[model samples]
Target: MGKTIAEKILSNHSGRDTKAGDIVIADLDFMIGQDGTSGVAIDSFRKMEAKKVADPSKIAIIIDHSSPSPNEGVSAIHKKIREFCLEQGVKLYDVGCGVCHQITPEQGLVVPGNLVIGADSHTCTYGAINVFSTGIGSTDLAAGMISGKLWFKVPETMKVNFNGQLPNGVYSKDLVLAFIGQIGADGATYLALEIGGQAINEMSVDARFTISNMAIECGAKAGLMEADNKVMEWVITHSKKKPNPQVADKDAAYKQVVEIDVTKLEPQIAKPHTVDNVCGVTEVAGTPVQQGFIGTCTNGRLEDFQVAAKILRGKKVKDSCRLIIAPASKDILMAMIKDGTYQSLLESGALAVTPGCGPCVGTHNGVPSDGENVISTANRNFLGRMGNRNAFIYLGSPATVAASMIEGQITDPRKYL
Candidate 1:
C-alpha cells in the first residue's frame, strides 16, 4: 500500500518503514523552543545532567512571546535564555526578531521533507512547506535537545481537498475556519491533516502557512500540504536553497476524505470563546467591536498586510475602536515599510507594534478591557486568550478585521472589497 506524506517523511527519518499507528524513533532536523517554553526545557536539560546539546546548529531558541520583557519576571527569563544560548552556542533570535514559526522558515531553518519539533503548539506551522513538524512538551523538547531524536506514534491521515477558486473577499483563513467548523474543535484529534486540492495548489506559500498554522486549533497532530512548484520557488527566493518537495503516494491511505468547493464559500468568523464557534460573516455582521489586531504566526505575513492596507487606505479606523498591527517578523515588517503598507495602516489610525507575538498571548500590546469586544486575525479565540477573561475575541481574516475596524463592528469583508 502507498504511504501518506506524513508516513513517508516519518519512515524516511526513522530509517524504517512507518504507517498509521506505528511507533518509531526518528531523527529531527530541528528542535525549537521559545521564551515561554525554553526556560522549562533548559531546566529539564540540567535535570538530565547533560553537558552539551546534541547539535547546537540544529537547536533554535527564540524570544518572541513576552518579547521585550513584559515584566521583570519575563525579563529574567529572557536573560536566562540569552545566557544559555551564549554558553551552549545555540542559535538565538532575540526580542523583536519575530515569532519562531515565521522566522524559522524565513531563515531557511525548516525545509521540505524534514522533521521538526518545537515546544510551541503552532510548530505545526512548518508543515506549510511539507515538513513533518509537531509540538511537544518541555520534557520531550529537552530530550530531543539532548539526544536529537524523539519517539513518535504515527497518526492516521485525514485528507482535506479544496477545489475551485476562492471567491473575492474570501481567504485561506475563511476556508480553514469553515473546515474546522465542519469537523468541530476535536474533529481531527491526534490525526495528521493532509491538505490538498486545486485551491491549495494555487495558493501562495504564505496562504498555505495560514492553513497549516491553524490546524492545531482543530485538534490536529500536524497539518501538511505537499510542496509544489510554488513552494520550491519560495524556498529558493527566501533561503537560496533548492528544495526536494515531498509527495504522497498515488494511493496513499487516508482515514477519511473531505471535499470543499472554495468558490461557494464566504468569509468566515470564529466567534468569541471558541475556535469552532464559526459562522459566515453575515451572521455576526454589525456586532460591536472595541479593538482590532492584525498579526500573529497565523496571519502576520506580507500578504496579510497587503489586504489590510488595501481596505484601510484613505480611511481612518473607527473612533470607538483601537487597531494594532504587528508584523510576524522583522523581515516582514521591513517589507511592509518599504512597500508603504505600514504607512497606509498608520495613516488609517492603526498602531504598529514590534514584530513579535504581542497581544496574541495577552502578555502585552493590545489587551482588551473588561467586557470589551475584539476582532483579530490571529488564530484561536478561546476565552481570556487576549488578556481579560471577560473580554471577547472574534477571529477573522485580515480583510475582515480591517473592514470591521473601520466600522467598529463585525462587517462582511465583501462590502469593503
Candidate 2:
C-alpha cells in the first residue's frame, strides 16, 4: 500500500506513518492570517493569553480584503493589525501588497512538501506548488500561531487527470469550472484534489495557481499538482528556499479518479449563486452584462492580464458595460505596465483598480448595481458576491470576460481567440 502525496506530506510533518482518516498533529511549515479574518484571530490570541507567537517568521499577516480601508470600522481594524504586528514583530503585508494567496507564493513563502495553513479558504492555493496547504478557522489560526502545530484528519486523495491539448480559447479556468460542474459544489468535500496529466504538466505556474486557488469553491481541502521543472524553477528563482516537490506513490490510493480530455473542451462559465452551476459559454450566449471584472486571486496574474490585452488590444468595452481590471499584486501590476498591457486595457475603456482583492470580496472598488449582470474572472458567484445580492455574477475565463465586456453580453471567447 503506497501513500498519496497528502499522506506523505502529513506523515513527514507528523513524525509518523499517516494515511487517510488518521489523526495527527503536524508541525506547520508556514501560516497566514489576512485582514478580513485575522481580527478575530488576534482577539482569540489574546483570550488564549499567549505571550508571543511560537515563531514570528513562520507566520504572516496580510491586509488585502477591504484594503485601503473601505470604511472607518475597517480602518480601525487595520490600525489594530498594524499595531499588533509591530508589537509582535510578525511580518505584515499592508494594503497594496496583494492578495494573501498571490503574494505568499510570489514571495516564496509556499514551497513543496510543506504543511501550511491560513485563516483564508483560498490558502489551498499554495498546493499548486506541491505543498499540503489548507484553510483554518480564526481560532485554529491562533492555535497554530501559538503552538506552531495543528491536528488534521488526513483526507483521501481524488485524482483528476487532464490529457490532450486545451483548445485555444479554453484556459485553466474553463478546465477547473468544468471539473467543478462534473463534481458538484460539495463533490470533493474534505478531499485532496491531485491534478495532473499532459495538460496540467504543460500548464504554466500561473495557470496551476488559478486552478488550485478555486479548489475551495468545490469543497476541496487542497488542490495539488506534482511540481515539475517549471514549478521547481519558478520556486527557486522566486525565493531563497530550496524546493522539495512531493510525489504520490506509484500505487497510491485514490478515492475517485476522473479522466478528462480537454481537446474539445469549450469555454465554460459558472452561473449566478453557485460555482458548480456551470455550463458552456454558448449555453448562455447573448446574455446581457452590465459590468465585467478581470481580476482576483483566482485569475489576477500577469498571464491573465496578457490574455485580456490580446483580446482587447484594438477594441473598447461596450458603451453600456463597465470593465474593471485589478492585478493580483503590485508586482503583477508593474509587469503589466512595463509590457504595455496596462495601457492597452486603459485605452480599451477598462478602469484600473489597485492590486488587491478589491471587488472580488465585494468590499469595495467595483461593486455591481442592482439588477445588473456582471461577468468576471473571479471565483465564486453566489448571491451578493459582488456587494449586492440583487446583482448577478457570471464567472468565466479572461478571454470570455473580455469578449463579453466588449459585446455587453455573454459571448464565447473562441471567436475572439
Candidate 3:
C-alpha cells in the first residue's frame, strides 16, 4: 500500500515505516514557542533541570502575542523569554516581528518534509509547504526542546480535492469556511488533512498558508499540501536551500475523500460563536457590524491586503464602523506600503496597526466593546475571542470583511468586486 504525505514524512523522520495510528518517536527539524506558551515551556524546562537545550539552533522563541508588552506582567514574560534565549543561544523573534507561524516560514526556517512542532495550535501552518507540523502543550514542547524528539500518533488521512476555478470575489478563506461547515467543527478530529486539486495547486503559497493555518480550527492534526513548483519557487526565494518535495502516492490510503467544486462556491461566513456555524454571505446580509478586522495568521498575507485595498480604494469606511488592518509580518506591511495599499487603506479611514497578532488573540489593539459585532478575517469566532464575552465576532474572507466595513454590516463581497 502507498503512503500519504503525513505517513511518509513521519516515516522519514522516525527512521522507520509509519502508518495511520502508529505511535512513533520522530526527530524534529524545528520546535517553536511564542510568548503565550514559551513561558510555560521554560518553566517546564527548568523543572526538568536540563542544563542545555538539545539543539538551540533547532528551537525558536517568539514574542508576538501580547507584543510590545501590553502590561508589566506581559513585559516580564517577554523579559524572561529574551533572557532565556540569550542564555541558551536559541533564536528569538522580538515584538513586532509578526505571528510565529508567519515568521517561521518567511524566515526560511521550515523546509519540505521537515517535522516541526510548536506550542501554538496554528503550528500546522508550516504544513502548507509540505512539512509535517503540529501543536502540543507546554510540557510536550519542553520535552521536545530538551530531547529534540517527540512521540506522535500518526493520523489517518482525509483527502479533499478542490476542482474548477474559484469564482470572482471568492477566496481560499471562503472555501475553507464552506469546507468546515460541511465537515462541522470536529468533523476531522485528529485526522491528517491532505488538501489538493486544481484549485489548491493554482493558489499562491500565501493562500495555501491561510488554508493550512485554519486546519486546527477544524480539529485536524495537520493539513498537508503537495509541494509543487509554486512552493519550490517560494522556498527558493525565502531560503538558499532547495526543498525535496514530498508527494503522496496515487494509491495512498485515505479515511475519506471530499470533492468541492469551487466554481459554484460563494462568499462564506462563520457566524458568531462557532466556526462551523456557517452560512453564505447572502443569507446573513444586512447584519449590522460595529467593527471590521483584516489580519491574523489565517488571512493577513499581502494578497489579502491587496484584496482589501482594491475594494476600499477611493471609498471610505462606514462612519458607524471601525476598520482595523494588520499585516501578518513586517515584510508584508513593508510590501503593502511600497505598493501604496497602506496609503489607500489609510485614506479610506482604516487604521493600520503594527505587524503582529493584533486583536486576533484579544491581547491588545482593536478589542470590541460590549454588545458590539465585528466582521473579521480571523479563523475563530467563539464567544469572548476578541476580549469581551458579550461582543460577537463573525469570520469571513478579506473581501467580505472589507465590503462589510464599507457597509457597516454583513454584505456579500461580490457586490463590491
Candidate 4:
C-alpha cells in the first residue's frame, strides 16, 4: 500500500481509495474550534438550519484567543459557544485550560491512529504525535459539524531526511527556515512532507513541533516526522501513557525525498510581513527592538521556557523593549511555576501573559504599538500579525528573542549559548 502517516490514518477512518489529489469526505474522529474565529463557524452553522452539531460528543470548543480577558464581542462569542455546547452536549473549555492542541493531548482528545481535523491552520501541529490532522475553513467546519465526514485530496509525500547532530545554538526553527528558504514558500503546495532522519530522531518533541507548526507557511498541505522514541516520550510524560499510534507501513509509498544536514545550520530569521522572506539572524543584527515576545502555539512549550529562562536568568531586558512570555498550556504554566522558571523570568522584568494564542493572532494580550519593531518566537510575521499593521515584526527562536530583549536589538542566539 502507498501509505503515508496521513494516508494510514485516513484509511483507518474512512477506508477509501486515496490517490494524490483525490478528494474524499470521510468521517472524522475529532473536530475543534477556538475563541478568535469559532464564533464565525457557529454563526455559519445557524444559517444551515442544522439544529444540532453532527456529533456533539466528538466536538470540542476552546476559548483562548482573547482568553485572559475576553472583550465584549469575544465574551459574547464565548457565551454562544457555551450555549451551543450545552444544547448540543459537547465538551467546552474556558480560558484557564490553554491552547487547544496542548490541552487536547493533555485531555486525551487525540488518540493513536486517529484522523483529526481542526478549524485553525495550525491544526497540523497535532501531527507531531502522528495524528492526521489538518486545517479547514469555518464553512467546511460547519459542514463537517452536520455530517461527521470531511473532504480532502490525498497529498503527494516529500521525504525530508535530516542527518547529523545540530551544532550549539542551531534550533529546529533554523532548520525549518533553511529548508523552506531552499524550497521557496510554495515548494510543497498540496504536498505532505514526511520529515525523518538521524538529526530528527535526536530532536525533542518540542523541537519537532517548532518545525511542523510552520509547515503551512511553506504552503505544504501538512508536515510530519515519523513517530519515534521522542514522540513516545512526549505522550508518556504528558499524557501519562504511550499512544502507540500507527506508523506508515514499511513498504508504504512516498513521492519524493529531501535531506538536511543540521550540523551546518546557524540561527535563522524571517524578515517582516512574509514568512517566505528569510535571511540569517546576522542580516538583521542590531535592528533595535521595542518589543520581544516568546510565546505561541509554535514555541510555547516547557522546553521553550528552558531556553528563554536561561538567557534572562540574571539580566534585564533593554529599557526600550517590552518582553512578554506565556506558557502554551496551563499545565505547562503550573509546571513552570513549580520549577521556578516563572520566577527567573519575573525577576528579569519579563511580563507574563495567559496561555492561549496570545499576540500571534493580534487579538489581545501583549499587542505591539504602532510602528514598533519586535522580535518574537511566533511562526509568522505577516502584515498586522501582532496588532498594528505598520509595526515591524521579526521571527526567530526563543533564545534569539530573549537575547534580543536583553540587548534591545536582534542578537544572534549563539551569543547566549
RMSD of each: 0.9, 0.7, 0.8, 1.9
List candidate 2 segments past 4 Å from native: none
Score every model by TM-score: 0.99, 0.99, 0.99, 0.95
- Measured with C-alpha atoms, the lDDT of residue 113 in candidate 3 is 83
Return the lDDT, model 3, position 42.
94
* lDDT, candidate 2, at 16: 99
Cα lDDT tens digits for candidate 3, 203-222: 89999998898888889999
Tens-digit per-residue lDDT, 1-417, candidate 4:
657777766666668766666677788888998876578888888898888787887789888777866578777888888888888898998886788867776677876566777888887876767767788888788888888888888787777888899889888888888888778788888888777777778888878887888788887877776667777766766654336486666777777778778887888888888787888889899999999888888888888888898988888988898888878889889988999998898888898888887787888876788888978888889889877898989999998998898899999878887
State each model's CA lDDT, in order: 0.92, 0.93, 0.92, 0.81
lDDT of 2 by residue, 1-417 (tens): 999999999999999999899999999999999998899999999999998999999999999998889899999899989988998899999999889999999998878888999999999998889989999899999999999999999999999999898878899999999999999999999999999999898889999998999999889999999988999889998888766778999999999999998998999999998999999999999999999999889999999989999999899999999999889999999999999999999999999888889798888998898999999999889999889999999999999999998899999988887
Which residue segments of model 1 deviate by more than 4 Å?
Answer: 240-242
> In each prediction, how many residue pairs overlap at the backbone (N, C-alpha, C within less than 3 A)?
0, 0, 0, 1
Q: Which residue pairs overlap in candidate 4's backbone?
A: 3-253
What lDDT tens digits, residue by residue, belong to model 1 across residues 1-417? Answer: 999999999998999988999999999988899999999999999999999999998999989999888799999899989999999999999999999999999999988988999999999998989989999999999999899999999999999999999899999999999999999999999899999888898889999999999999889989999888888888877775445577888898999999988898999999988999999999999999999999999999999999999999999899999999989999999999899999999999999888999799998998899999999999988899988899999999999999999999999989888
Mark the regions of model 4 whose C-alpha exceeds 4 Å error after superposition.
Answer: 237-244, 249-253
Q: Pairs clashing in candidate 2?
A: none
